[model samples]
Target: MNCRPRIRASLLASCLVLTVSSACGGGEAPHSAAVGGSPAAVVVAISDADRAAAKQTFETVCFTCHGVSGKGDGPGSAGLDPKPRDLSDKTWQASIGDEHLRNVITMGGAAVGKSPAMPPQPQLKGNPKQLEALIQHVRGLAR
Candidate 1:
């Protein structure tokens, strides 16, 4: 089936969120954005460029196990113990700090007392901004 309508609808929704954000006297998401149905859900108010980069990184690296929307049900996750993290989990996402997220992504799960199955993303390390973007992208998945 064609998905253009759904895609357009999602795009429109996102645009509306931006417009609402601007009208509220700032370009930031309110608290509701953290859980869903808003812009300020994960990470923080980020630039478009950063959002794009983070998304690309997630799609390229994290999607294999985290799945497209981070539900932890990617094709590869089926055979793994503990499975990949469901990045879309709002509570799980909120409880974790940005630093913790960076550590897990940069050094891998084993370094942070998590499952060893999660690989280290050395390429994402050392770059603070890029790391933050990925964290934000993960946060956005909660929505």
Candidate 2:
């Protein structure tokens, strides 16, 4: 069985969804508008597919340095000067805000005066759904 084709196809589909969503302004916004002047603050649920994609992305991309459990002890972190952050740290998680997380994730750690080893994910700047899914996934690791 050739798993490469399946993996390629899944990646292609995910990329298509991301491209289409960005092109169609599928970023953050209310699912429906309210009857009043301002929009409602209804929480949008993350689909299982998106959640799975986020997990895959984290494993493939971030896991190189952050590890599968976000312990900052991945194989790639061995050579890094400053170790990657442990995502499950309750104190650290409580100290940061979502916006700060978003900024660091999108603009890299150095952008927020953190570690320069954390590369910026410019691709996620336009895809709020995936970005938010990744953020939520990180938040879920809090221990």
Candidate 3:
């Protein structure tokens, strides 16, 4: 009942980023990688409820490698070889499809032909919604 406004603001910002990520032609993931252009842009203005869920998931699950801004400079990136991809970089980020991102997260980087440093999240196997949220969070980082 007494949360800090700054924390709330940060969560909102993260939500906005994820919404834009999903809207930016990333498709619904799972073999869908096309950036659909302007129509997708409109969806970037997603509801706060969606952002809250995406932001919370990212903070707890991905902040280690992707960091708060998804810049791949988290505390866990020190000894990595290829280094974590900067999720916030639009160009490099664009090269990766939403499904590819999902694969990398759920099945790890090796599953999607990426680094071994990026471990797979088998625990999320049965949770389709959470996996989707993670993908959206990755997409949001691009924004």
Candidate 4:
């Protein structure tokens, strides 16, 4: 038996799976272009009120599953299969970037082949501004 042919076939299958997944909206949401005409120039400006509101929202809805410190150690997390993500990890957050975070929160991680324990926050219930603030707050925790 030629192992090389088998390995190539397996690799091709894996790549096909990943490609199909991404094409079917199983990847990060596309980033919005900034007013300045540069995708990289887009910046979310959060106010103190927005931050406070986001903190409250996170405390009320998120803390139950993500923990008070965003460490994925919430009381409800005990029964979860995949468990919540540790928000305090700067490395992970940094690697994913703001766009990915927004997508995860808006569309959910499960939509992107991540842990399905994370549910999407409907835009109607979660204001974009508040969400942006929460993202900033999570980013601050990465240190």
lDDT per model, in order?
Answer: 0.68, 0.71, 0.62, 0.65
- For model 3, how does the per-residue alpha-carbon lDDT over 2-104 read when each residue is reduced to its tens digit? 1111234234443455545542224343222234331111122345565677688788767788788999888888888898888899998767665566557
Tens-digit lDDT track of model 1 for 81-110: 988988999899879866677678988999
> Which segments of candidate 1 are over 4 A away from where they belong?
1-47
Which candidate ranks first by lDDT, i.e. highest? Answer: 2
Tens-digit lDDT string for candidate 4 (37-127): 3232223335689898888878888888998789999888999978888898878876776667767777787877888778888771235
Output the better candidate (1/3) by TM-score. 1
On the 0 to 100 scale, the lDDT of residue 129 in model 2 is 67
Off by over 4 Å in 4: 1-44, 124-126
Across residues 1-143, which tens digit of lDDT does each residue of candidate 2 receive? 11122223244443445543442134433233232432222123457887999999999999999999998988899999889999989899988866677778989999989999998998986666687789889998898
In candidate 3, where is summed lDDT lowest over 10 consecutive residues?
A: 36-45
Q: After superposing candidate 2, which stretches have Cα over 4 Å from the reference?
A: 1-45
Of 2 and 4, the candidate ranking higher by lDDT: 2
lDDT of 2 at 120: 93
Q: Evaluated with TM-score, which candidate comes out highest?
A: 2
Residue 38 displacement (Å), model 2: 18
Comparing 3 and 4 on lDDT, the stronger one: 4
